[model samples]
Target chain A: DAGITQSPRHKVTETGTPVTLRCHQTENHRYMYWYRQDPGHGLRLIHYSYGVKDTDKGEVSDGYSVSRSKTEDFLLTLESATSSQTSVYFCAVSAGVSTDTQYFGPGTRLTVL
Target chain B: AQSVAQPEDQVNVAEGNPLTVKCTYSVSGNPYLFWYVQYPNRGLQFLLKYITGDNLVKGSYGFEAEFNKSQTSFHLKKPSALVSDSALYFCAVRVLGGNKLTFGTGTQLKVEL
Candidate 1:
């Protein structure tokens, strides 16, 4: 509903392989975030970007990386996928403030065997 | 650091019955609280947020949340339950100046007819 869309809604890949998910927003929000949702962990922040070429690591950024080359697009890449990295990845965008509400994309379910 | 806790793993309510999902948080400064709902395979949808001012915050889909600073809680409530309301609910918190949000493990709501 926030003009956000995630590509490759579902994906499956073998362990030790590389994977990437894309998030696109038409809202032109300045803050973009990537989160992984697991059963016991509601949603853990993986990485976020506040502006073009400006990014920061989140609580669980161990095996993942992110890049925001433009205001409308953010990319999350798994250097080498692992079984433990299998989870639903969600992308969120906000209007550049902590108090502003963040809207989420449809999410991508990734499985690593 | 800011963190949120969803005490119940699941909640059940009959149609037309009042429903509540509990949430508690800990933060170093004034908190920005939020509630999100995820319907299976979909992304998280913003339900409501509490930044300041009124303690009772109303949101989408007939949902409301009360921010109790004394209790450090922001619980999601609905006057009457609907079977379609069954889904996963998540609580999140952000400190006054923090740029990121910390989320709880989530609670599953089961509204039956």
Candidate 2:
């Protein structure tokens, strides 16, 4: 919904291997965010971008990186996967920061062995 | 720092009965509160939001949330529960000056027949 899509809905990779997740939005929103969901932890922000080539760290940005080169795409990368990083990742977009409601993509389930 | 807390891990209600999922938040200045629902294997779906004006905000699927500024609470409620309403619910608060949102762990609602 919300014209959002995530590539590789499910993925499995070994620890120490690089992995990337893609989030695409057709809503032309100005803000995009990446978040990870785990049991008992709800969801934690990984990174966010306010505009192309402008990104910021979230509370749990460690060991992960993100890039937003265009208004429609935001990418999250795991330089080296870890078992602890295994979780369901979600991408969301908003028209603006204040008072704007976020719309989420389906989600990507990633597992690290 | 803005934060949200969902005190209950699980809430059970019978079909046709009223249901409520408690969510309280802490933030400086006025708050922007939101509620989202997640079914198994799906992404979070926006249910409702409270930006300003009336505290009682009605949302999709016959759901409503009340934002209580004095109590610092924004609880999700349904006048009558449906079996289809069983899902994981999350509450979030947006940062005052930023678009970033801080989320609560989540509450699993089970509506049984």
Candidate 1 positional error at A39, Å: 0.4
| Per-residue lDDT value at B48 in model 1 | 91
lDDT of 2 by residue, A1-113 (tens): 88999998999999999999999999899899999999888899999999999999998999999989999999999999999999999999998887898899999999999
lDDT of 1 at A50: 92
> iRMS of each prediction in angstroms?
0.8, 1.1
TM-score for each model:
0.98, 0.98
**What would the per-residue lDDT of candidate 2 be over residues B1-113, giving only the tens digit for each residue?**
88889999999999999999999999888899999999999999999999999999999999999989889999999999999999999999985577789899999999999
Q: Candidate 1, what DockQ?
A: 0.85
Extract clashing residue pairs from model 2.
none
Candidate 1 lDDT tens digits, A54-107: 999999999898888889999999999999998999999999666998899999
lDDT score for candidate 1 against the true structure: 0.94
Using lDDT as the measure, the top candidate is 2
Tens-digit per-residue lDDT, B3-100, candidate 1: 88999999999999999999999999899999999999999999999999999999999999999999999999999999999999999998766888
